[model samples]
Target: MKKKDKSHSHSHLAFDHVSFSYKHSDKFTSVFDNINLTIHEKEFVTILGPSGAGKSTFFRLASGLEQPESGHIRLRDKEERHRLGKIGYMPQQDLLLPWRTVLENGLLPLEIKGMNKKEAREKVLHHMKKFGLLGTEDHYPHQLSGGMRQRVSFLRAILGGNEILLLDEPFSALDSMTRYMMQEWLLEQWHEWDKTIIFITHDVEEAIFLSDRVLMLTHPPIKGEIDEVNVPISRPRNEEHRSDAAFMKLKQDLLKKMRSKERSL
Candidate 1:
C-alpha cells in the first residue's frame, strides 16, 4: 500500500501505508489501516465521512501531532519519518487566545520558531491586510465576529510557513451566511498562497465547493484504497456553480456514497 513518486512538483505529501489506532483501556480502537495517498503541491483536498468515522484521527496523523502505528508520513522537503512543523494545522475551533489581540495571536507561531517579535509583527501586519484583518489587529478574539476569529486562526497557521496545511472543520461553527463568506474568502486565499491544503469536514457542499478532490471515508477500519471524487467543475467557482448541472450531479453522487455508513453511527 506504499506509494512512491519521484516527481518533484506534484508529489508534495505522501501517506505511505499508514495505520493508526487509539488505545482505550485494554482495547485498541482501530482508526486507519494501510492508508496510502498523495497530495500534490498547491492542491486542495477535503475529507468527508459520517460521524465517528475517524476523520480527525487522520488529521492528527497528518499534522505529526500523533504517530501512526506503522508506515510513513513523508513531506517533499524531507525523507525521514519526522514531520512535526513541516505542515501547518488548524483545528475545528478557532483556538485563538482570548487574552491576545488578533495580530499578536497570529504571530504566535513565528515567535515559537524564535523569530523576533518586531519582525514577526511587521510580517503579520503585511499579511493581515490581505486577510482583511488590517484595522482589527488590536482587537481581541472576543471583540470580533466568528468569521474574524477563524481568519486569525488561519493566519496563525499560515505564519507557521509550511507549504502544506491540515485544517479540521475550521469554519463549521459559523452561521450559514458567515460560513459562505468565509468559504469564498478562503478560496481566494488558497489561490493566492499556492499551498497544499488537506481539510476535514462533514458538510458535503463545503467539501465539494472547496476541494480539487474529495476523499470519502466509506469504510471504517478502512484498508488500502478509499473513495476519491474529483470535482469536475472549474476553479474560481462562485455561488452560481451550486446550481450548475455538473455540480448538482456530483453532489448527489457524493452524498449517496458518503451516506452509506450514516445509520451505523
Candidate 2:
C-alpha cells in the first residue's frame, strides 16, 4: 500500500468541481464548470476579475452564504466545519450601524458569540489600537472619515476570532490617497493578525499591491477560474514602487490578461 500525501488528502478549503446556477429559474445558466481551487493556511489570495465573473459568488460560497448547485465545498476546519461564523466577511459597503458607536459596532460579533461585554470591549479596543481606530471608539460611523470607517469595519470583521477573511472590495469607496494609505494600513494589520485573506477586487493594481497571489477570473457568470499571478514585490510596499519597472510589468501583464479574456467573450 502506498502512503498518502497530506496535501493530496485534504485542503484547508477547497472548491471541488463546484458548479452553481440560480435556483427557480428556467434559464438555469451555469456560472462555472468543474471549478477547483484551494486556499492553504494563512495564504493571501486576491480574486481579480471583471464584474460578473463569479468573484462575489466565490466569496459567498467560501463564506457559506451560498451553496453550490453541484459539487462540494470542503473546509478542513473540523472544529467548525461549514459554519458561517468561522469566516469574517467585510462587504463592499462599510455597513456600519449609524446609531451604534464604533466600539459597539466592533463588539457586535463577539457579543453574539456570547463573549462577556468586558472581554469583547478589551478585544475590540485592542484591534482598534492595532488598526488605527483607537481614538474613535465612541464616534458614530458618520463622524469618521471614509478611511476611518473602513478601519472600524475591518476591526469588526476580525473581532470574532475568525481565521479566514472574505473582503469584497473593502477599499473601493475611498479617494485615491486615502485608498493607498488604507492599503498600507491593511497590510500592516494582516501581518499582525496572520489570517487567511481572500480579497475580491476588479482593480488589478490594488490586487497586486496587497496580494501574495492574484487570481484572475474570466467573464460570464461562472465561466472561468483564476489565473494565479505571483507578486514578487517586497513587504511594506509604498508609493515609490508603483513607478518601478517590475511593478509596471506585472500591472501591464494583468491588463493584457484581462483584455484578452474579455475579447474572447
Candidate 3:
C-alpha cells in the first residue's frame, strides 16, 4: 500500500521530542528517547508491535496518564502539561464496574464533569440505542456479554467529550467473530462521531482494516522516528475488502515485519 501523504493535514496531537523512563528497582529504564510523532485531525492511526514495545506507554504519555521526563506532548498544536480529562481512553479490559448498572457506568464521565444528574442520564439514554445498549441499561457488567460490556465501556469513553480517543486493544479479549463485528461497528461509530482515533492492536488485519495508517513501534528504549505504512484500502470498507489482493499482501508484509522484530528480542 502506498503511504498516504499527510503533509497538508492539521496536527491534532503530537509528541515533541518526548523522552520517558520507568523506575525499576534502583535504576531508570528508558521507554522512549527523544521520539516525535504527530497524529492528524480525524485520522485513525493504529500502533502495532510485540509485547513490551512501549505501545501502552505511548498511550499513557499521549493521554497524560504519565508525564514525559523531558519534551512536550501537544494537543491541537498546543502543549499542555496536564491532559487527562482532555482525551478519551479505553484500556484493554472493558473495566466496567461490576456493581454498576450499564447506565450508571456510562454516566461516569459526565458525573466527573459535574453535569446535572438528570441531564447526564438523559444524555446516556439518548445514545443507548445507537450503542446497542438500550434495554441493558439496568443490567450490571457481570450480566452482559463480553461484547456488550465493551459497548458500555466505549459509550463511557466518548461521553468524556474529547475529540481524540486512545484505544488500547479494546477487542483483544473477544471471540474472533465478535471481534470482527466490533471492528465494523467501530468504523461506523468513527464515521458518525468524527473523532481522531489512536488505536493499539496486535492484529495486523485489524490495524489495516481500521486505520488510515499503521505505526510500528520497535522494541523498548525506542528512539527517533517510528516506522509506518498507510492503509491503501478506501473508507466505508466491508467484509469483501478483506479478501482483496492488496489487503492480503499488506497483511503478509506487516506479519513479516512483526516476526522479525520479535525474533530480534
* Residue ranges of candidate 1 with Cα displaced over 4 Å: 1-9, 114-116, 129-147, 261-265
Per-residue alpha-carbon lDDT of candidate 2 for residues 1-265, written as tens digits (9 for 90 to 100):
1221224433467777788776665667667777878787666789998777878878777788778877778777343336587789987678899999999999899989999889888888887887778888899999998778877887788776788899888887778887888788777767777777899888989998888789878764544354678888876577788888999999999999889978977
TM-score of 3: 0.90
Tens-digit lDDT track of model 1 for 172-210? 767898778778878887887777889888899999999
Clashes of 1: 0
**Model 1 TM-score (2 dp):** 0.86
Q: Give per-model CA RMSD.
A: 4.5, 5.1, 3.1
Off by over 4 Å in 3: 1-7
lDDT of each: 0.83, 0.79, 0.88
Candidate numbers, best lDDT first, in rank order = 3, 1, 2
lDDT of 1: 0.83
What residue pairs are clashing in model 2? 31-222, 32-222
Model 3, span 139-216: residue lDDT tens: 999999877887788788889989999998888877898788889988988888788899999889999999999999
